[model samples]
Target: MAHVGVVGPSSADQRELDDAESLGQGLAQRGHVVVCGGLGGVMAAVSRGAAQSGGVVVGLLPGTDRSAANPHVTVTIPTGLGELRNALLVRSCDVVVSVGGSWGTLSEVALAVRTGVPVVALRGWPLPGDPAMHAVDSVGEALRTVDALVRTDD
Candidate 1:
């Protein structure tokens, strides 16, 4: 199973939250691990979905408090790195699925691409063309792209 990181803003809109949750559920049902910043908004929603589906979720928290993680996170690692924890989250995943947009999400996507990790963006930023990155409109498309990128042997 692949380690899939889902990144978005702490203050996300309804659409982004819904999409992130559904993507998390689908990824979990498919046996992939869910990784996130381990706070609110997209991170919380995704963790809830994956946990509800009986999937393992790894929350790389930005602060030193493990209690700062969402209730659904199965594993919480308090990095205390602030925004720099984004790099740790990206590195922990085989591929990242970005739901919606934010400066923080943009940074994660950029890091993943520059480091040769594939990214599947769901209604994310308008980034420069990169072979490792692709913008998708729906969660199904994102899952398909993820399945193709994350090999079974990994």
Candidate 2:
């Protein structure tokens, strides 16, 4: 199973949240591990979806308080590294999936792309055409792209 990191804004809109939730559930049902910032908005929705579907969720929190993590998180790591934890999150995953765009999400995508980790962007930021970065429109496309990348990497 792939360790898939799901990145997005903590203050996402309804559409993003819905997509993130569905993405999480799909990733879980497909036997992939879900990783996230473990706060709110997209993170919380994704975590909830994944947890409800019997998937494991690793939450790398920016703060030192485990309680700050969303309740759906299966394992909480309070790194206290602030935004720098984004690097750790990206590095820990086999593939990074962006449900929406934010400064933090952009940072994760940049790190993953720069470090040779595959990235599947779902309605995310426009990149400069990196081969490792895939832009997708729907949750199904994102899952398919992630599966292809992980299989190719293996």
Give the per-residue Cα lDDT of candidate 2 at 147.
82
Estimate, for each residue in 1-82, the C-alpha lDDT of model 2 and write its tens digit. Answer: 9899999999999999999999889889988999999999999999999998999999999999999999999999999999
The sequence of per-residue lDDT tens digits that candidate 1 reaches over residues 1-154 is 8899999999999999899899989999999999999999999999998998999999999999999999999999999999999999999999999999989999999999999888999999898999999899999999998998887436
Task: Summing lDDT over every window of 10 consecutive residues in candidate 1, give the lowest-scoring window.
Answer: 145-154
Error of 2 at 126 (Å): 1.6
The TM-score between candidate 2 and the true structure equals: 0.97
lDDT by candidate, in order shown: 0.93, 0.92
